[model samples]
Target: MKFGPIPTLQAKGSILAHSIVCSGRRLRKGVMLEDAHIEQLSASGITEVTVAQLQENDVHEDQAAAELAKALVPDVRAAGLECTAAFTGRVNLVATGPGIVDLQADRLIALNSIDPMISFATVPNYQQMRKGGLVGTVKIISYAVDAEKLRSACALGSAAIKILPPQLKTASLVVSQNANRNDEKGISAIKTRLDALGITLEKVIATEHEIDPMAKALSSLKSELLLILTSSATSDSNDTAPAAVRAAGGQVERFGIPVDPGNLLFLGRIQSRPVIGFPGCVRSPALNGADWVLSQIACGVSLNENSFAQMAIGGLLKEIPTRPQPRRPKK
Candidate 1:
């Protein structure tokens, strides 16, 4: 019966009444019509309804009280309330307090809904309201995940289910083609040497191929870490180690290391997952990049570029030989 920005305050020959909900589509100055009134309008063949929450000071009823009141409705209101009307232009009301109240109309409308509300309307699907959904991947430089450490981080995310995507699997080896002829051993030799060190095939399985399926498997299984065993090639030689992983048709680069015995070792990722390659020295029980990488894994760190760069300091410490010389008996 009425149509305008200010809403027709006075209607003619109509049992129902109406008021302004907001000022020209802005979410200010609205009415708090009762749900019963909305239902009345619905039954009267009025299908559309829009709701808004107005500030208490909006009403000029008591000019003196407007200063102290944050919002204005004919009456004082609280937060978390909604004012409704059968139409859009005019609104007046202030519904407040907790608990969700039913709001119905002819067609479903998106008045003030946030993100997840209209996903189908956008090109890129909207992010889920819940955490962990569509979260970007994190790369770890370490070779394996420490279950205890990973479990702790999972708890913080409050994720009932954690998933490690398949992009994280990597290869492990005791020797590298990156090293000199004397130092470089094939994958078989590295495995054999590790076998001699009391490390069993079951403890760290070997793959005929360069990379292992376990990395992919663990990631798909939401695994938090991947452990890779590798041998160092040479120290300070400017040589690099082989790629930790390569897609079925991916590229491989750098084969030797520039460090000491730890030089031949390498650490890299397959699918953006963390990877740690142990040098031959890991077999010696001496401190090395492998140890530091393992510690980081145990701490559940993602081998992101920044985290990888931070390992330089620890790697330098590994190069130190603090072997204590036997002290002669004091006179």
Candidate 2:
């Protein structure tokens, strides 16, 4: 059965509000958007527009693009911005006068030289890249954009996508208890905690599960972080414990936080993706493992092995002042 052509798909998920630009006019600073305005934009063809109070309390670039996209509706061009969609909150729109066949090599060269982590994803210009021809709709992520890079990228046979270091979304939560029922309960508790923090957890998987199958699932879903929470009592020696992580790829880290009730926590990641292990203490109302780890990851801090180790400097030790010993007995 043939389904009708669907419109272009952009990245969908929670994104940070970096900067907001609108019609090159910053929406009046304190002016709250009216629902009527939102409805009007939506009906006019602006799809999936959502507004919320932001940490910055002021719009920046990303927010500006999003708002412009929302206002322009059916006619993105009418919005006064140069691009149809902006990904990664960092983008440079090169106006090719509406029929430009390709972005130039200089564009990619410029963006690449500035940051090695810059990457591209095949977008509307797939055929162009294949034929060494130019196309449109290249998405790029870079620390900064160069005018030359913008020109060169568009000059390519087709528009190309430049993405940053791929972000891992799959988090592995390892429950140590042998009882399936207990493991399920622990997983439920952890999920609840994560949800409160606005982190969407994918699944609670068993450790013994095969890597190939597990990886296949994660790949299909495009998950980047892995979180492991343990309830099993393994020897501190690390000999009896199952592999800390099953994935042959990704990052890993262990946490022994200074926070009360959660000092026993451990977190590991396979690559840049997170693999966190939360001890039973997370269930307690007291601040626990999930609290600290969740905050760091939310702020875009990659919890690698070294960062985890650094966490130990002030984390595990307790402050106990020495009390003066009782006076010695008289001879």
Candidate 3:
């Protein structure tokens, strides 16, 4: 692209490089200087203005950004997302329905690295968003980019972000028999959190705190998802909850995550069904590691050891001030 001063009379069909105020009206940058605009600038006594003229191989900014954004998003709409028309070298990914934004951070990083002129940004991975939320955006840095660079960036960014509809629709809660009064509060809190995600707590199984009974309960339970709310947090893969999962012929994917307030969370699967061993922090509805794990499960995102490990980058859930405050002593 060639950018330099061009006489207003000769600037027709070129993109304005900067906004100019003329006769009480503003001519914004990126506006293609039409004959009318050229006449208006001449009438306003503007002799010359800086503009960008595209070379034969250069792609227009808006078209390039729109194509890259299209390549980045998956072909499947997934239920809650809409892609806006590219404008000003930007295409915004908006949420059409309320749900979690599931972004592939690693792929996004790769996409951005492919070209300096192309970039993308999104709400944090696994963020709960309302309808019409800005989930992701694609931006091209210059008035125009080389066609080859745009194509390379698009190849790198294909299917890098997804808006997943909440999928943890039905669940069963298994609590220990020695569950205290706090258990009621915890159950209520879990219900409220799940309800927000459109998950229903269809059945409750209260059993002895022993591993054998827990295992039996898990083996016998029939639900799309199983949640174990233990009186105590599991300390290891061999802990009671995880042990029960193993005894019930389930595979324990991971024992703990790097996220605080959710460090004790356990993830396991039994015959294709997900089982989450909740940490004590789950008793309260504050955002925590458990919420993160649950949100991923609900969104149908695959979970494994590496998935929990990758969360360390943004795992500081307790640092948010709006997080539920610890109970204070009665005056």
Identify the leading candidate in terms of lDDT: 3
The per-residue C-alpha lDDT of model 3 at residue 276 equals 92
| Model 3 segments more than 4 A misplaced | 74-80, 95-107, 124-131, 164-168, 177-180, 206-220, 236-240, 243-253, 320-331
> Residue 262, candidate 2: how far off, in angstroms?
2.0
Better of 1 and 3 by lDDT: 3
Q: Each prediction's TM-score against the native?
A: 0.27, 0.36, 0.81
Q: In candidate 2, residue 161 scores what lDDT?
A: 32
**Per-residue alpha-carbon lDDT of candidate 2 for residues 204-230, written as tens digits (9 for 90 to 100):** 555433335444433333345555545
lDDT of each: 0.32, 0.40, 0.84
Evaluated at residue 66, the lDDT of candidate 2 is 38
Q: Best candidate per TM-score, number?
A: 3
**Model 1 — TM-score against the truth?**
0.27
Model 2 whole-model lDDT (C-alpha atoms): 0.40
lDDT of 3 by residue, 1-331 (tens): 9999988899999999999999889999999999989988999999999999999999999999889877877673654567888999999988876568876677788878877778898889878876788988889888999898888788777877777887667998888767453488778888887887778899888888889999988998888899999886688899888999999999888888899768888889999999999988887667888888887788788976677778898887654333344434337
Predicted candidate 1 versus true structure: per-residue lDDT over 53-80, tens digit per residue: 2233222212212211112122323222
